[model samples]
Target: MVHEPRSQTGLSRNSDTEEIVALAELDPESWSAILAPRLAYFAAVARAEHVTRAAHQLQAPQSTVSRALVRLERDLGVDLFARHGRTVSLTAAGRTFLATVERALGEVERAAESVRADADPESGKVAFGFLHTMGSETVPSLIREFRADHPRVRFTLVQNYGEWMLEHLRSGELDLCLTSPVPDAPDLVARRLDEQRLRLVVPEDHRLATRKRIRLAEAADETFIMLEPGYGLRRITDDLCAEAGFRPRIAFEGEEAETLRGLVAVGLGVALLPPPAVPRKGVVELTVTGQRAVREIGVAWLKDHPDTPPVAAFKRFLLTRKGRLLSFSPAGV
Candidate 1:
């Protein structure tokens, strides 16, 4: 003989309700066992691949790393890497698992930092990450002002490319970053600091260098000196060239805007660049026809850090000088 159990919402409480609550609190052992070891292993793998330069970054012996990785694989009940010669590459499962681990660890770190920040708002160290190009201009000024205003604040600044900096910012490794506007991340809040138009930097004797309004296609055959791919300027230049129905003939690849400009000055190749405040002595700046490539550069930080004193003061300075900064934009700007 069997009886129907009453639902929790029904008049009487059932034995099943207490059992369900107990299971919710303690019975998910299999899921927990799978997740914790996997995340810890994923962190080791991420440090091995993404953050470190050499195969062993922390002075750990190569055998130690290999043994640790093997232990992780054993604990996870699957292989996470495939080795070819001296190199180790992630397996498909490894890639998928790594993303989840990175995200979870990031959230944990942010939550921990939030508690620490709440406790000591003014005394802890702060890091400012800046894009390489912008760091040449805006960073020095801001750093000087910040150091003067907050003598007690410990500060560290890193110069890196845009995409890499964005990843570090999202991970809470960076307190704030100065970079051009990227497609906004949900957790990010950007305050516009300045805007500038792109200009053509070419050798002084080049034909297009003399023109006030030359079409993009006109320079299509010219050797283009560009930053390596993954750079924001390279992406913009490639898009602009594609839109103009041609591709650029890249002759030299560089990482620095000023270096790219210097290459153009020395007859290496022409480059499309944002009008930076630094002057290139022999390079000519030309106006592109029907195009004023513009980008807005700004300060970005986690939205929850709105009242951070240094962040607030930096925003105030940028906003106050934004008008004067506009004047430094390219000629057409």
Candidate 2:
């Protein structure tokens, strides 16, 4: 027989307090199921500040909108709106709740849009990653040819070394990647697209610059500017050097192949690199003889991950270009 205190809006203050606490404890599924629809109606009404106008905007009957608002306030244990004839104004509580509700609704709308975009065949997005060496020409040509038929498809391109691209693929940040040495991981699916010949690049004035080809062992005494460890190209360089019966004298370590090539051009050191997209001045590229000095370039993705339409289409297009992936002119080489 205890009488609860009442608020100015005629709501039972004690019961409203208990209800607010209980609402906070609801499980995610229960909260979402019970409150999502009510929140939409509340937002519509809050924006218009009039039930009749909000109902028209929502294309719902005015009675339905009023009932939803009443139910929402009752469930939350507070009066969210102050009624004055046919017009309504937000209570302080309503104003606070509206800010959070709007953000949640916006996130939900964006999520819907993202999923719909992924499912679209003609205009979906693909998150693709690739080696830095391929960015200048190889990737551009591949994308241009693929987009000939998929003109509306969008791409999110990332250029990084092989191992970093693989990490992004595992984390779901990348849908597909073109990487070197054709990674042999259990969690990844890979196909050898082509092999790029590695060349020994030195300054134009260096002793071996005039030779078109030489055994890798010939540069054993030369200071080498190599990519830092963890890059697939660096690993290939190390292994190839080891096979040639000499460890390269390390002069400098860098991130990008082109940057290392630039260092070689400046006479800092020599480096083993892929053929440049355009012939660079001040450096002579010599083919490595007596040892297989080529890195396998392959397309890779998570083994069991499902691809969106655009990603799947691009993957298929890439597989079709198996031996011809690079498309570099012999003159450029």
Candidate 3:
């Protein structure tokens, strides 16, 4: 697109026309072919501060490095360096341009590494991230079951909270993740594997220990042991308490669900938690009656990412286990 400069009378200037024509002739691809190698040359020269030493470091001739830098300055319309005898120093413009060039080089290197990693189908790796709660049982079971088929497939597992895990998924650090209260994002492909019911656990000798089923509001006055603020369980706890028409009085906050269970076992405070795979001693699990007392666990991956062999296999294995959730799953969510 060309914009002809116009005066108040709408007459075009000849000087502006010539400038636009010259600008139009500057093809970006051709210029980049000329600029890319020069950027490397500039970086080397900036580092060494001496043309001869910079050329030696790059294993190139001194004349070649010097000529490239001169042409680069001409093309960019900036004074990149000031030479005093054999020593060189970067101009203000040179420092700013080097910062951008370094970032561009890093991105290129990462792209190349990713492409090479993707090309290897044999003995490939899957970066599988998941929730801390699922790491103990659900995740392990899924991996073991999946690996039975693809024995050579490797895994890099990460355990993190709900939204945090999704960040890893988007960045391509994780091929897939299992998270609770599945995150809603336009860029993510999420499938609800199943919903696992969370039970209200109390110490064996507590007043509500004998009750197999109870309403959440019934224990409004009790001090609740909750996961810290960012956790998916904590969000569910707050929502469930809100549904019950009261805010829980938090007695303790911790990172892991098992730690919260431990706190409950000693009578420190009662907690609303997922039923442990093997019920921890000294704590009794009870069903919460009103509203749903379940968290929806699901797998998520970036919609734009091309799945590797291991990632695709693992994902298919997970989908097959849709209705077959963990051992503690109740009749309904």
Best by TM-score: 2
The C-alpha lDDT values of all candidates are: 0.67, 0.88, 0.82
RMSD of each: 16.4, 4.8, 10.0
User: Which residue pairs of candidate 3 clash?
Assistant: none
Off by over 4 Å in 3: 1-115, 327-333
Candidate 1 lDDT by residue in tens digits, 107-169: 888999975763354554567787777665566766566567666655678988777777887
lDDT of 3 by residue, 1-333 (tens): 998553222223344456446645878776786688788788888888888898999999877877677667766878787767678888899999988988887898899887667545656788888888777777787778777878877788898888888888887788888898887889999999888788999999999999999999999999999999989889998999999999999889999999999999999989998767566899998999987889988889999788877678778888888867574333233
Task: Provide the lDDT at 277 for model 2.
Answer: 84
Model 1: ten consecutive residues of lowest lDDT: 6-15
User: Mind giving the per-residue lDDT tens digits that candidate 2 earns over 1-333?
Assistant: 977654343333344566567777887568777778889899998898888889999999877777677768767778788877667789899999999999999999999998898769999999999999888888888988999999999989999989999999999999999999799999999999998889999999999988999999999999999999999999999999999999898989999998999999999999999888888999999989999999999999999999888999999999999998986643243
lDDT order of candidates, top first: 2, 3, 1
What TM-score goes with each of the models? 0.58, 0.80, 0.67
lDDT: worst 10-residue window of model 3: 6-15
